[model samples]
Target: MNESALLAILLSLASAVGYALAAVGQSRLAAQGGGGMGQLLTRPLWWWAVGLNAAGALMHVAALHYGPLTLVQPLGALTLVAALPLSAYYARRRVTRREWRGAAWTLAGLTGLIAVTGPASPGDALSLSEALAIAAATALLLAFLVRAGAHSSRGTGLGHATASGIASGVASALTQTVTASLSHALPGGPLPWWGTSLVAVLVATFAVGGLLLSQAAYRGGLAAPLAVVNIANPAAAAVIGVALLGESFHGGPLGWLTAAASAAVAARGVIMLTGATPADLPTPLPTVLPTELPAPEPAVRITA
Candidate 1:
């Protein structure tokens, strides 16, 4: 394989691992019955998960350096594929047949996407107006999520998951934008003042938003929200790349439409896996307290 392809594969694997670890950590947190942001940050395991995610993001950037946006962007969906088995292993939870079928569907769609997308060069520089627009849009979406999350009930896990997915997707998009802008600035010797400033703001925004969303998603169900975000993020980026960056597919418009349809199918699969009804999830085992087991003492006396 070529260097770009190798990088893409490696980065995709790294991202999958990172997301899996993050999912595990999140599941542990929820299992612990921890609530609120304060409780979350205190856990050492959560920190480790965050670090893993950061490492994954770094690998993703590296992949972008070597591969086309079209190829690199879609490969992120691999995280969704990886999360299921990893969660099962770590939590000792079994995935239902529905989940496996859903994952398969998602994988098939993403595979079609990768096959159809055409390679293209990234833009040399993002115009000032474009940077500002992206920043504004990201901010607006985040603000909306925060407002919505505030009103949502704690037990409504799916709501939290959806919000987190949206936040993570927006953050991922901003991160890509920053990466592209920085790359453009680097080739010109000294980075332009405006470009540097814009990139810095966007990077910070992306990182912070991504962190919060990830934490919330972890609080929800790691598998569901992570799956949702993984699918949504790449889909959004791919759309931007095609619409704004002039990227296209192999066999023209018909091929592009077919790839999109496949992606939708894949997305439906992911939703099916993670969007289990109450009956699907394991029920909490009832606790037996010492007081509740007092009958054991009487039995011992009778034996004596």
Candidate 2:
């Protein structure tokens, strides 16, 4: 392999390791189960996890800069395999067989999906309409996930984890689109002046959502939930690539079959993970509510 490719691979692996450590660390904090977001903010481990997460992102960005998307993204699936044993391990929880199976299936499926993702279209920028459609779709999905999570006890973490993956995927898609638009030749001259910045804003919004949701998912075990995020992220991105980014499956009908099978396998893995790692009750934090005012308010109305 060329030096660039080799460097990208090494960086990707390092990125995977960083993400695994960060996820496991956050999982440890969530498993302790003490306080709310306020308390979570005070914990040192949380900050460490955040720092590691940032480091992982930097590594990933560097990898992407150095290598092709097809190479960099596929290697990202390594995070699933790496996080398998690290989940809640700090809490002295042993890895379960079910978690192992889930991780294997997830990794296999994600690998297959990446293999078939094919290359992005040369020099194409996402149209404004396409970006809007993606935004609308993700918004609806997030709303549904949040509402669904609210009613079901077990589904809460799963829902948030799923939302995290989708948000991250969408954010990535937008990021790639905006970045490509700036550097590459656009078919229609250029994207509008505000278009790139608007997409950047969207990217930030969804990236933050992804970060928070994934943290919420760690309230249970990191392995399964992290697996879910890993699977969903690439799956969602592949869909965007094919539908909106002018990428296509290779090998015609066979490629489509492979894609479908990979998706099903990934979905099954997610299902298994949700059942395997049941969510612990989240620590309830205080919510601000209006306290009852004295009857003196009636006197003020009368005076007015």
**TM-score for all predictions?**
0.76, 0.83
- lDDT tens string, model 2, 1-304? 9999999999999999999888888777877887887997899998998899889999999998899978998788888778766654554566677767877787778888888878666665567778878988999998899788867655777788889999998997887678777875666656777987888888999998898888887775666678778877877887888877777888889999998999899878877776676543235688977699656544445553
Q: List the residue pairs that clash in candidate 1.
A: 106-266
For each candidate, how many residue pairs have backbone atoms clashing (under 3 Å)? 1, 0
Q: How far is candidate 2 from the true structure (C-alpha RMSD, Å)?
A: 11.3
- The segments of candidate 2 whose C-alpha lies over 4 angstroms from its true place after superposition are 34-36, 278-304
Candidate 1, residue 41: CA error in Å? 2.6
State the lDDT at 107 in candidate 1. 73
- Highest TM-score against the true fold, candidate: 2
Error of 1 at 283 (Å): 2.2
The CA root-mean-square deviation of candidate 1, after full C-alpha superposition on the true structure, stands at: 5.5
- State the lDDT at 289 in candidate 2: 75
